[model samples]
Target: MLGVTSVDLADRRELLDRLEQYYDAVPRSGARVEDFGPLSLFIREGQGWPFYVRPTLGWSGSVSAADVNRVRVRQRELDIPESFEWVAETAPALRAAVEQAGLAVHEHPLMVLGPDVPAPAVPEPADGVVVRTVGPDDLVLPSALAVPHLAFAEPGTGGGAAGLAELGEVVRGRAGDGSVKRAVARILAGLTCVAAAVEDNTAVLGGCAEDASTSGRRIAGARPVAW
Candidate 1:
């Protein structure tokens, strides 16, 4: 039964891999290859986060205990200072390798959306706020909500600049493709400021906001997502 279950799991993994490839091929800024391998790293640059890391395949290559030193060494070279995301199967060896490398691990429930599901009714903006759909050009808002956008992972988990740049490149590519949308909703002191890009219908991409305070300084969320 264990062997049968393993085979079944492998088969499902293969299917998901293929689907991920198709999604990654989509001409959107956030389209990503959500699979496992050393070369399969996704770094979101400037925002300070590791976008995604999939499990390792035996043949393509796995992130092992031996790779720990290399991963850390490269991280320093890139100047990345935050934790990043990494996924592992129920493999003790793999998990042990990650932990032994001083990388923390967290379990996240995987959620799937069925095709037959209907879209929820769009919510009306609260009083003193508005929502609008915006293209890439409209991503230039400065607000307080933008601070936590890229806080997905702790820094330094992946190697430094190279890793972050790679992730940023993916995001830039998506943004250039016009697949990324910005929804800006703001409320000022005792008043509604503006609401833009109210609805994000798909999970394929994420969004970010730039924040501007009275001090004339600007800060943005570390990561971008539609939610």
Candidate 2:
């Protein structure tokens, strides 16, 4: 769960709008854009799942079953998995419209921390573990990324079978799928930030942390747009 307590709805709505605008404007690596009136489909070029179907930036009219049907038909034509994403509060009608189109609608709780919210204090890493922000050029980035896979796979402080070789294999596999390159592009383009925890000269665990609000209007040269 994300931050929900003591939230101001107006401020949160502004941030959500910002996020939606940013996502619509920014380039998603390994995906191509296909627009259909109120919806924009992010189709995967190769590898991985299709991105998603989302309301276009600045879309405000109520979404209807016919609207959902058009996008679904296009997705089926393209052979991509059917998926729709939006904020329930902002898109109250979309849920019903999607369900009416015979696609399952799932609600995901969202936590929006506006610029007004003070960041939480940084916690100390475990002894022998160092937590730090990872730069795009950092040699340990792949290992930093692999830590999350290891962390969830085993769910413990110990490294277990999830070590450099195993993690390296994971990284190599991502490279083949262009995930590594795309992730690096995102970091370099200021679209996201990465943090890592290192142990034994390796990011053994607690790595692959993403910093939100790393993009959108904050990015250099991007036109200012409300989310």
Candidate 3:
């Protein structure tokens, strides 16, 4: 594993640029876009939430409250949650615009592993456990997908109340949902990757990288690394 080190401005800017490019490609695959000068508003072709506003590609300046509101109004008109997403470090000025739009801004720590280094070795799974990447069509895919739902279903971190029965129920509940199809489409397009930590043929834990853009210069991280 790589050690922690102070990152310079060039490193930060390069990472942000790659991230911006990666995200910009994602919506184009399945969403409609409305570019508003300094920002681009993404609206999903079908559902919501994944849709958001981000700084326009190669746009130099920051957005204003008016710019933020333009996207917000479109969101409201379309009856979707008004959402904006971006790296705080990359677009410091956008925060004020978001706040001025009467929206609460929440910050989540970005854990970006520097990609220009050698890839770390994959660690062994727990004893008797197997860790490997899986395709969307795998039999246990639904269960793997269920992990997040079950995990968030329980509030605190005092271990879970659920088990195999609950997991099976989750899988069965959404039988006809288009999740499998969507997963297949995305994965087949080289846009998504899913990992499973399986023991006794069940997915006890899962991880995923969706809509990844590995083109251009290699700042290189695997499904495990990168932002």
Candidate 4:
């Protein structure tokens, strides 16, 4: 059995609000959300990524099979994969419905740091390693795609070029609106890359291993907006 604390209710509401605002900030170019009662159907048109947003529901409220079918019909209409993200603690009914539809369920950990927690320390980079901020214009999408692809390259798989090319197309598509630049800058500020190198102000790195928070709550360009 799962235990619920008094704080859980407050946290759930806050999380939902944050998620809604984050999706709202998504560019108007290819982003749209179709509200389905408590579920927000998020579609990034042409990107082939559609996500269902499920809010915390009361135990008395159970997800119906109709809800599952609705999602299926919509995905079929869009010709996109079926996917939804919801809090495990609050989505028992929806979980069962999706599983019954034979779709694989994936659960991911949600992490949040409070002001009281001490900020994590950034490790010293190895010798000859240099880390610097590179603007969007300074780096090509191919080089950005290479960072993760090269880092995760296997011994003899040998599909790096093709995979990188496909990813480059997607990256360039996203970069056109400059949203990718803002997002990456926001990410790298909080997460320090350990094996990163700056050549001509462009970065190629291994992995991020640090939280980008300070003692205060400021993150990169903007302060956390209250909802």
Alpha carbon lDDT of each predicted model:
0.39, 0.66, 0.74, 0.50
What is the C-alpha lDDT profile of model 3 across 1-227, one tens digit per residue?
16545576566677787877776776676788898999898888742125888888778876899998888888889888788889887788999998988889988777676537676797767798877788867887777776667776776545587888887888788667766667778779877677878878888877676654446542322333110
Worst lDDT 10-window in candidate 1: 183-192
- Report the number of clashing residue pairs per model: 33, 2, 0, 1
Tell me each candidate's TM-score.
0.46, 0.70, 0.78, 0.55
Using lDDT as the measure, name the better of candidate 3 and candidate 4. 3
Candidate 4 backbone collisions, by pair? 190-212
Off by over 4 Å in 4: 1-30, 46-61, 140-142, 145-202, 206-227
What is the number of residue pairs that collide in model 2? Answer: 2
User: Taking the tens digit of each residue's C-alpha lDDT, what string does model 1 give over 83-182?
Assistant: 4343343233556667877877777654444347785697765454445533323442322123223323335333233333343444454453322222
- Shift of residue 140 alpha carbon in model 4, Å: 5.2
Of 1 and 2, the candidate ranking higher by lDDT: 2
Looking at model 1, residue 20 earns an lDDT score of 44
TM match of model 2 to true structure:
0.70
Off by over 4 Å in 3: 1-7, 46-49, 116-123, 152-162, 211-227
lDDT of 1: 0.39
lDDT, candidate 2, at 198? 70
